[model samples]
Target: MSKIVMFDMDGTLLDLSFDDFIWNECLPERHAKIHQLPLSESKEKLYQFYQSHRHTLVWYSSTYWTKTVGVDVLKLQQEFQSKIQARSGCIELLQQLKEQGYICWLVTNADRASLRLKLDNIAIEHFFDVIISSEQVGYAKEDINFWQELQRLHPFNPDETIFIDDTATVLKTAEKFGIQHLFNISQPSSLKDIKQHQDLEFKTLDRLTELLSILNEIDRKDNDVKIA
Candidate 1:
């Protein structure tokens, strides 16, 4: 079986503080200034607008939001580049996964511009065997059709692959595509409490070593049975 491991970028590998800062703080502040409304009112209004297209591809498009919100999101992100960083222990986890012979791919809903910015900021781009953006695939990860297209372009057996993501909605879509090994990152943002989910969740990337050990043992036993 192909030991392919797919990772989500924003929350899984990178700290989500940057995104939270943009959506919850920067954009809202900009909206308040542009519309001459109170900050709180602008925040509420923009948040409602954000929710209206939460699961769609447009939600992840930096350019789309920039136009819609009448703000330069990409420029704002650059201004707050200090907030873009990898989650603690993520680099170690990626190294361990590579040493264990797993093919690691970064699969994210982030648009190309955002992806490039974050990757450059963290300098962890070389860690991934391939980085795939949902924008390139013409679908959001929340759609099963996106997974189908992903598999078509970069083939892997869903049963043999493991996918780790912070978003429950995207995980559900991956499950619908019959991905057997799934994990949820309970703590996507350090500022927030661990997000509850029905599936097994990891609080940090440090648990990755143990998780891979268990998978390796299971694979060993299965191999032994086949030999016998």
Candidate 2:
């Protein structure tokens, strides 16, 4: 039997601090400079925009943001691409899963342009059997249609699949879609405080490699059940 592991790229395998810095810090400054507004005013305006588009496919599109905000959001990310980084133990976890014959998929809400930027900076692309951007699916991961479209494109047994993401809303949608095992990252951004696992809806992983032991235990139980 094959076990498929689906991972969210940002905030799960990759540290989300770069994204935080780009949106919360860098973009605000640039928006202020270009619009000749106060820094505080720029942040307030951008926050409103973010709140309105939260969890939507438009929220993830760099092209849409650039046109709406009048800033080349993708170019700003490129300028600071050096800050892009993988989360701790990310490579080790991916390597271990590969060695154990698990099928790994990189399923991300990032648009194709943003996904390309991250992949260009990080060398972990070779680890995934399939890499999908929500842009191709025509919906964000927060929508059930994304999962449905993904299944239509590349069929997988949801009951045998494990999904790990940093966002609770995305996890909820995946659960609604009938994926069996789900996980949330305890600390997605190195710059931010670690989240309390008890507060999260799904089980949390503090270290990316912690998943290896969890998978081992799950397999052991499955074998015991078969033996009995």
lDDT of each: 0.84, 0.96
TM-score to native of every candidate shown: 0.91, 0.98
* Backbone clash count, each prediction separately: 0, 0
Per-residue accuracy of model 1 over 58-89 as CA lDDT, tens digit each: 99998998888888889989899988878877
Off by over 4 Å in 2: none
Which candidate ranks first by lDDT, i.e. highest?
2
- lDDT by residue (117-189, candidate 2, tens digit) is 9999999999999999999999999999999999999999998899999999999999999998999999999
Model 2 error, position 166 (Å): 0.2
